[model samples]
Target: MARNQQNELQALQDTLYFIGGKWRIPIINSICNGNKRFREIERSIPGITTRMLSKELKEMEMSKLVKRTVYADTPVLIEYEPTEHCRSFGKIIQEMIKWGESHRAIVLKKRT
Candidate 1:
């Protein structure tokens, strides 16, 4: 393969390694949709447990998709907010959501 093609393939692989997970997209979306607190995220995603959410948040923070802020207080509160890098994904996710909804409508209507 050409150098340009090889670089492009590697970049795609990195992107997949970064965002290819069951929880990453939902975690990003929840943060984008205004759930910053840990509990808030847990509540926003119906089936995610505290442990899994915590792990996902930590991973996102490491990947720079989310920022973690801790307030200096007697029981310090931690909030997870999406970084600019993550905000860039908003348009993509919006398009995906539109596609998903359209597909769901067609499939469900066919089923019923």
Candidate 2:
């Protein structure tokens, strides 16, 4: 159709690619909220397994949005922190949260 419609569709695709999968954005939001360790993230997310958390953390690390560090002492602990790149999109995430809340409210109002 129109050039603007094509651009809009492309942007939607890019956004989905940027925040794909069930665990990615939740992991990002959890890390952003100061859940810095693997166990802590698992604990905060509640239903995520240790294995899945580790896998997602590694993926985010590779994607450059999350930083993973391991300290070589005793049991060997690993910590996860969001990179500056992830923090740069704070406004976008905030807007998504706001939009979701507003949409839910309107939909609930219609239902009731």
Candidate 3:
């Protein structure tokens, strides 16, 4: 492949790897939509098990996609918020949502 094509391919691969898992994007969307607490995030995404959410959050923190903050209160509270790096991907996610809606409409129209 040409040098430019190789670079583009690598970038696409990185993006795919980042958003590879079934839970990652939904987790990000939940957090970005103001679901900070663990339970809140869990409830926002139906069909995600407790174990999966815990595992995904840890991985996301390691990837610098989310910040886990623990508040020392009478009852300790933990919250997860999207990091600046993750926030940068918000526009792309929005576009994907738009595209998905449009694609579904087209497919349904064809079936009709």
Candidate 4:
């Protein structure tokens, strides 16, 4: 591969290393779409266990894509929200949604 191609591939790999998973995108979308609490996120993404959610959230926080806030209330309410850095992914996510819809339609038509 050419030098430019190698550099581009590395960048893509780095991006994937951060958010490449079945759970991470949904987790991000849930929080971005206003599902702030832990239970809300878990409910939003069906089939995700509490353990998995906790683990992924910790990873995202370390990557600076998500922020966890704890409020000193009667019971210490915790909320999750996407960081400003994560806002950069909004367009990328939308493009992925568009591509997925088209790909799904194409594959389903082949099946039927």
Candidate topping TM-score = 3
CA lDDT of 15 in candidate 1?
74
- Structural RMSD, model 2: 2.2
- The collision pairs in model 4 are none
Q: Which portions of model 3 miss their true places by more than 4 Å?
A: none
- lDDT at residue 6 of model 1 (Cα atoms): 95
Off by over 4 Å in 4: 109-112
Model 4 C-alpha RMSD to native: 1.7
- Estimate, for each residue in 1-112, the C-alpha lDDT of model 4 and write its tens digit: 6999999999999988877788988887777778889999999999999999999999989989888899999999998888987767855787788999999999999999
- Over 36-75, each residue of candidate 2 has an lDDT whose tens digit, in order, gives 8777788889788888888888887898989888899789
Task: Give the whole-model CA lDDT for all candidates, comma-separated.
Answer: 0.86, 0.84, 0.91, 0.87
Clashes of each: 0, 0, 0, 0
| Tens digits of lDDT, candidate 1, 21-77 | 787788878899889899888998888888998898888788888899999988998
Ranked by lDDT, the better of candidates 1 and 3 is 3
- Sort by lDDT, top down from the best: 3, 4, 1, 2
Give me candidate 4's TM-score against the actual structure. Answer: 0.88
**Best model number under lDDT:** 3
Considering lDDT, which of the candidate structures 1 and 2 is the better prediction for this target? 1
Which structure is stronger by lDDT: 1 or 4? 4
Q: How much is 31 displaced in model 4, in angstroms?
A: 1.3
Identify the superior model by TM-score, candidate 1 or candidate 4: 4
lDDT at residue 96 of model 3 (Cα atoms): 88
